[model samples]
Target: MRKINKYILILAAGVCFTGCTKFDDDINTNPNKPAKVSGTQLIANSEMYLPGIANNAYGSLYPQYLANTTYIDDARYTTVNFNFYSLYYGPLMNLESVINSKTLDGNEGPVENQVAVAKILKAYFFWHLTDRWGDLPYSQALKGSENLNPAYDKQEQIYDNLFLLLDEANATLTNSTGAIKNDIVYGGASLSWKKFANTIHMLMALRLSKVNENKAKTEFNKALNAGIIDNNAANFVYKHLAEETNENYWYTSYTRQGRNWYALSKPLVDLMQGTADPRLATYADKNAKGNYVGLAYGLSDAVKVEEYSLLGSNLRKQTSPVYLVTYAQALFAKAEAAKAGWIPGGDAAAETNYKQAIEASVRQWNNNDVTGLDNFLTQPEVAYTAAEGTRKIATQRWVHLFLNGYESWSEWRRTGFPVLAPAPNNNNKQIPRREGYPTQERLNNTNNYNQAVSSFPYGGSDNLDARVWWDNPNK
Candidate 1:
């Protein structure tokens, strides 16, 4: 009897020791971080990356709207670096949690409304990811530790899913009851969210204009009917706080860093100058000669930076708004759709949308200067030309999309308009179509990354020249 009791006590001691070492550790929470956060809080945090990871610098150089004086590599298409993990870990994860907690635990306010918002944001981030780098870890992504190595989903599938997400969001908003708080972008206005979701849907539909005409038209019609931002009053822009922590990244990069690294490109300056575009004065500052002078794109560092104009002070303002998408951009897309026969009413409709786009863009930058807007649009070169309508529309968009580089670059790729000349003295000999996948993916997620890149057009060496799936119009 004594021996048996002794054995049982020893077993109990072993069990307690195992619980302390393993079970307790697993169950412990880090009080510093959230075990669960409010849906609104998660949304506000996710909204921080709305302008995206890489901003105007990458976009401007690729589209030949801006040039780098010192670091000519980005301009020359030599050093193409972009990372996707930030999106995966940051906004995507937070959004996924919002949806999951709302659906599962039922704690988030008005599950339908919060879930809808989460879906919309998820679609937006995924759209950027798949567009920037063809094929991404989509369906299985944001699974946390359950599935660390998510499979790379095809870009086509991703687009299809994105459309479905927007459709559900639009429908859900119709009957939504709750409000999303701390909405840094929309101030929790559901109507603005509708315009934003539909606008983004229109943009995504236009993205398919090159690859899948049928899908493009179908989605375009759906989004246009649902409505989009009609005026700058409805634009999707994030005005930065005056505080340091959340100040505009561009302001920090340009002013605080003390680098006049960027200047307007020759193409943009000349085009605006030729048309006497009103936005030019807002877009750039005059050089020492009191005239707009731009640095030639892809110039070597040997060129003296002081001779050329620095970007306008507006961009470096602490509270300058970051353009995510604008009413003007949506108008331009509508014009393109009408021109392409994706919508009804032909060239006349296209002309209307095209002109409205230019007018709206001018006013957005020029503080509602009606005379300047009217005069600028009335310029012969700026007027709607039916014969070269597509080029005209695309060119205006290239200018209108200033500072919002990624979209401008994507527009250039899709429309093949504004016919950008290849950067001179580029080592690659061809313009980069997609930013290269991060080196970390190659090292850690080796197998999946290899499998994903292998599916690219160039047999997956992760080259900068590899065109993203949508970049090929003929595909």
Candidate 2:
């Protein structure tokens, strides 16, 4: 009877242990898991993207119109410079790792906020890529560890995919369920991300209006209907801190001796001078003589010394914000679209919006002053004239995009605005439509690069004036 009791007791103990193990397993099976992040950290890791993108776009290329040292000085310059290539590949490559890994890992339950941000950033980067290069690797380009050599996709296809991604991002940004943590641009505000997504769509549509009018109009209407960014408050800018490590792109470039090479060009200075644009004072500092000084592009060594002008690295200041997109730019794009009849609006309304865009841009300069803005608005050149055609609209857009050289250059290529002069010694004598594949790409993906180049119109040479597919025609 005692032996029988001992066996029963042992069985009871085993049953209790099994029950405890099952309870612990049930507790551990949580549906909501913390997101795995590696690439999104790259954006917040340092002040890299903000300054890096700003420096290349505003600091180097757009000022090509002004002709300065830090960039190519030959009358006709071709070939991808280091700065240009770096901006093109650096951010994309980093973001790609995060995106490709997440998709391939296939561990989806609840959506990761960082993954959504990565998608949005990826879309933004691709927008730049398409605007610059026309056709490039899109769907397969950023496969992380999977598929090392991704094939290139046409620009049209890329745009289609981009639109899809933006839609998904908009849907995924529902933060009511869970919040996005490290959003440096919008502070994890899902509403702001939605606005950013819509605004970017508008810009993208405007860019494609020349090539695909119907598609552009449709996208524009969608963005407008969805409600785009209304004012400067909604501008998508990455704020820079005064700290040396956190200094703006301009400050970093100008303060560093070897890197402190660029300056404002004569064309840019002349434009401000002619318009009496107040922002000039803030954009550039006066020399000892109180004159707005800048270097002329394509100048000889002796001329540069005599000029007493430096390249425009003023954008490198710690105060300078890295503007991913601006309310002013969006307004200007809308005005252009309206004038082009890409949307339902008249010239008067478009001109009003154009002037407003200019005002917004000037007001946004350094100080948010409305003083002198009215007088500046009334300038005969800026006022509405049907004969002005798209030139007027595009030129004003160019002015607003002044500090942002890459966008300015892209717009100029698209619309032939601001009537830039061809480089006197231009090898191809054409403005560069797109940067060539990076040296690494050439070395690593030689076959793919060669195949892509073969499809280019000018034998794949990085000619300054080679027009991309979207550029309407050579002026």
Candidate 3:
């Protein structure tokens, strides 16, 4: 696809918009930046910002898969700014711009496909935002020349709209023709996009298992019938380039500093060792003694980091693929759904789906030892127990989503599986349920921000201790 820098494009929009005037005949004047761009260019630009949302440090730290060794602020929940607002000005705006441009002038490709993709992406970003901050400016967000302090929409409302957007994307994709230009995610293939939309809807449905069971079952059945990602080939993944500006975020962070700043966490290492998980080698490197050791998370002061295993080479490489949603996640979601009686299948189907999730995870990491995989599936503790089947799926999902912090932490909150311990040195005396809103929003949009914080069902404060709308704490 195209390689336009999203941030640069956003920053230089006014410069690009300046029309050619009296000096139109000058040859020395550069004409590289077009006065206006197509929906294709905007779609391509939006893909480049995925790393900002996916490869950041909060999700990994919250899930206890990776920890900051030198400075424990993030692990202990001291870091206030997770840069939540950058999402609205950056990727979200870019995507909405695509929708606006396409709608106004028609589309270079099929208008339906262009608008559908834009809507799907818009919903995707909104989902990411609302999950992090609870309620947000969803209904009125991305209005370029409209209201400044857009009112925040409730989390339930956002989810409803997201489901509708995904359904619309599915229909438009099936009915339209012409490849989506600059579509880096699925190479312009409409079928892949359709599967992605449906599977994403399936994932969101699973999130509602604790809060809204009836709605969850309804959406789950619809998404399942519509089809979802079922194999490695159809997984929603993206690989960063090897260039200086385009390298993977983890790779860039490590290369600029040292790799020892962050190390594998003790909880994750213990879990892997307890289960004899072969994926440990795939997640972390061996220490000086050639054994996989992990560092304790949330230490107050700087300490020796070389004593523990660093991140694995496969993940640290500039070319590593960042998995957003995967077949493994889909299987585990189904397993849990079946176990909860949301679907027609019973315990047997849950068992099958659970086993498939484990196998798919193993193979996804390139671990192809048949004997090891078979043993892993059949182990007494690893095997699916009738009473503990849901927990089994939840724990495996946490394992498979190793570096994906937000999703891993979300599942743990929803299912209460794996029983992750709270960080020892956290100032709050407990693990944080949701991050605080950005400081900028509090300053600039004080009234709106305060309104959202007050309307929060659990409490009217935007503290880390407050749970999001769907956070079924007792689960």
Candidate 4:
């Protein structure tokens, strides 16, 4: 019995000692560092935030002018008060961190492919920044916390840099190899990246056409030679997963919270309705009485509630892809280039390409099924006639870009297609040229903001709608 008791005591002491050792280790040892994140993870977070940015671009400032859409009045009223500067600064700032940070995992650094993706994304954000605010910080913008008061670069210089960055991205896409994890769009497919890079090149060239014809033509030719998106399958898009967390950017704004905030504008609806466009059915929904309805561009509170029809469920619950660039847009760009005699193609060829581009955009919206589109193409209003100029091509492009308000707004600023009436109650009775610097700029970077505003053609006032450097009539 004594022997047994002694053995048991020994076993208990050993157990106690082990437990004490573990407790000591837990109390005194540094906590395990979190698993190092990857460049792909950083990219994923950046991609995830894009929809919100896009939503704010269209919904807040450039509200739809259609009759059945919602928030026409509210959008106009709030535009002056909304803080859009954050939209430009926030995402780009975060992405800058990911771009500069050497190792996502603190051990394994970013690869060539990761760097290429980051550069492309950076260019995209800068494109929006320049388009919206004219001149903004470029080379010095994303130095993380180290350069908080970076000086603004001219829009012309920014465009030059965009071309350079895009060239680098194209080269990287062509050469980089191995699987790219967290590539939610293309699954790290090099071919798709190449196509997207070329598409962006084409877009940038067209954007610069008004300012730098020679450079625009050179880039345009380069993009065409490199190749563009072949079809909807190769489109650059970010798909939403249908859950609230992954829901479309304006889903809540159009649905539960606002209820009936936006409706189609009269001009847009008239264009679709007058031409008997099939996309109207796909884009909008029938009301309780089965009638299609839209809202006026600027509505006052005194307006009757029944006058504003809610947007159809088609748009409200739309799970279709959100486009970054499409083959149709490339075709339209080709048509525009051809119309300007920048390309070897003549009017007939340009018309053919324009028609194809229009068809491509329509087909993309219709799930890439080209079945009935051919018949629709026979209609004179819907078809491309050889006599038409850049206006025709641009008009069709605008229609295809419907629901993609930021792209539409940008296109309008670029081409002035689908001519819209001035806002009835525009504060300055002038169209907004660009969003103002955020009020926070006064607090955070007052000197820089003051310098930028002082250089503006219209006294750099917030209300001026003067075209940006690249958008003005020069080239």
Candidate 5:
């Protein structure tokens, strides 16, 4: 009996030792570094990627808003392909995680709202991608190891899916309550997001104008009726904070590093100066001579930096705001729609929208100061003429879209306005219409890449000169 009792005691001691080992493991684990990030955290990660477009100096060179002072390769269109790998691996993947997350972010917001925002952002990223690269892995994308080598989807098909995703998001937000947590863009305001989604919807519809006018008109009208961003107060801007992590890219370049590589292009300066556009005060800074002189874009020889105006002081500040889509953009879209007969009231309404768009843009850039606006509007070149309405609106829209490179570049491709001349020493001898597919696509997804290249519309080839589907009016 004594031996059996001793054996039982030894067994109990062994069990206690094993349990204590497990407890020690639990206590040593780091609580701050979560095993799985919450949906809110993932969405915040996605928002961090918005500044890429705003700070794209290369993209700005394409539209002639920025001139390369010493290095002019990009301005001369030397680079043919731009990698979008970071976009997919970073923001897009993070948003996809939120969409697939089974656990709700309780008190942060309803699961529906969280998922809806993710879907909206996902659609936006895809929209930006397709505009730059015509065909992409849409349906099969973000599948992780499930589909390692995904086939590239046609741009047309991708557009269809984007529309569906946006629609689903808008509808899902209707019944959802509570502000989304970690929402840096709209600060958890669900209504603002709804308006922003519709604004994107309208803009996408307009892209189809040249290729599919009927469809474009129908979609544009639908989005307009559904409610888009109509006022400056609700403009979508990426507000950079006064911290290292969120400081404006210009601040890092000019202030921190003392680099002055970019200057306002002659084309932009001449246009603004010609019309005495009031926004020029805020878009550029005076040179050493106290004059707003611009640099000749894509110059092969280096010029004296101080002879030309650099970026405005406001633009280079640590916390300078980057406007994404603004009320001015929405108004310009409406003005174009009206002029195209997509909306009611015709040219008369078009004129009204055009004037309002300029006013809004002027107010936005000049800190609501309209000191020289009235006179500037009456200038012959600045006045709205129904006969030249299309060219007029396109030109003004380009002016208002200063520094927002991708959108301006896309607009130049679509409208053929402002009459940009190819750089004198350009490699292609013409402004590139589209970027070539990344080299990784050819190496890793050979079959799919070959198929996409061969299927290019309007006899397009996989080159910088080749036009995307929407850019091909002949198609």
Candidate 6:
């Protein structure tokens, strides 16, 4: 029931600490950045970072949804060590501040509600970071003035703690107190927060199916039993505004800056166009020739941008919604879990959820219009078959997650469905399994960084090919 005040958000950004790896060791040394900020301000600042992460250029490129028209280095997988300091210092640190704050004024709802929201958000941010780069400084990293150089926690360990954090948040949630302010996502609605936390838990649990099936089953069912995003209205979406300060990322890039660096990747366009996918029109625009033509995925040579389709207006418009977690995601996760026997009813349940998942995805992407959905589902490749259920669910889920590159990339690594090939001229020769640790880690946290790289389960190498704990190719 509350709206974000841009001026307050601007003020929050100005006063908060800007850097962390060592939890911004400079904060204590500098007089300008505040040592402490309000719980409300901290949460607001953390929420502000979600849109940028959701529309991450690197994230989209990794899954081959978008292709580079000019700078092809990222498409070619040239960068090895992608830094995550922005995440840690930005949302992660801000959420941690809210979680640790002893003083709460109830401006953003009840004190307990604030802490619960903070805990869920903290878990979510860490989940995002660990998925990107395994073995992060979880338990030890947030202590300011106490531990400057914290050791990295293994990905498995981080996941375990993340599950617990979500559980704690879900347990503490109470009815919404209408006084909640500066809360952009759900207007501080406690039920919506509960569903979101549980939804996150369910998805994270499914991520472990390849590595630890028993734990995955237990956790997946636990979260499902608790609750999740059951309807489109309850989806975790970041609503972008028309204002320059808070406009959609694509709008800012294409409309304001007039930089059209990316086009729909050939693989994505071909698959969608071939399938008569209803969402394609909403996902991409017709090229100069007035047909939907995708650009080549990782071409080394310069190419004409006009030959390929650009991102759709629905996506690039200033007020376009950026979906983070959605009912479709929950349904697809359910479809996967049903096929895996994590939940009862087996193929029957899997088929039901799979059908609903596709419907939900079509509706969500096409602005709640299911005009051509029935015929689309009856297609041989799209239809749910028990023998081919996992592949079907995985592929559809990947499609549903368009523009959400990091999540899709993680799923592609785990499932190996709708098999994506290495970029033709990729520097690694294979698709990157994980991003290398930031180069700064080698200098600032030398010993710990070395320890993490050495203890890495898959090959013990700090290269892009090293798989994260849950991304077990053997499974």
TM-score for all models, in order of appearance? 0.89, 0.82, 0.91, 0.85, 0.92, 0.93
Which candidate has the highest lDDT of all? 6
lDDT of 4 by residue, 200-297 (tens): 87888888777778989999999889988888788878777655656665576666466565556666766777776767777766555666665566
Show model 2 residue runs off by greater than 4 Å. Answer: 1-47, 57-59, 62-66, 69-78, 81-90, 93-112, 175-179, 258-260, 302-315, 426-428, 457-465
Each model's lDDT = 0.79, 0.64, 0.79, 0.67, 0.85, 0.86
Ranked candidates (TM-score, high to low):
6, 5, 3, 1, 4, 2
Model 6 segments beyond 4 Å from truth?
Answer: 1-7, 10-37, 176-179
Query: What lDDT score is found at residue 440 in candidate 2?
Result: 70
- Name the better of 3 and 6 by TM-score: 6
**Which scores higher on lDDT, 4 or 5?**
5
Cα deviation at 173, candidate 4, in Å, is: 2.7
Residue 88, model 3, lDDT: 85
Steric collisions counted per model:
0, 21, 1, 22, 0, 0
Q: 138-176 in candidate 6: lDDT tens per residue?
A: 889978778878999999999999999998988888885
Candidate 2 structure quality by residue, lDDT tens digits, 1-475: 1121111111111123354557776566543432343333443432246545544633344435344554555333544633234543566766655555654222222245555666778788778766766667777765556766777776778888988888777767675654443445776566777788888888888777667789888988888777678888888887776666556655765675445355566667777777777667766656546688655555434244334345333455666776668888888887887787766767876887787888888877755877777777667766667778478778877776766667778877778777766555545445566665566767777777677766664444643344566665533
Worst 10 residues of 5 by lDDT: 5-14
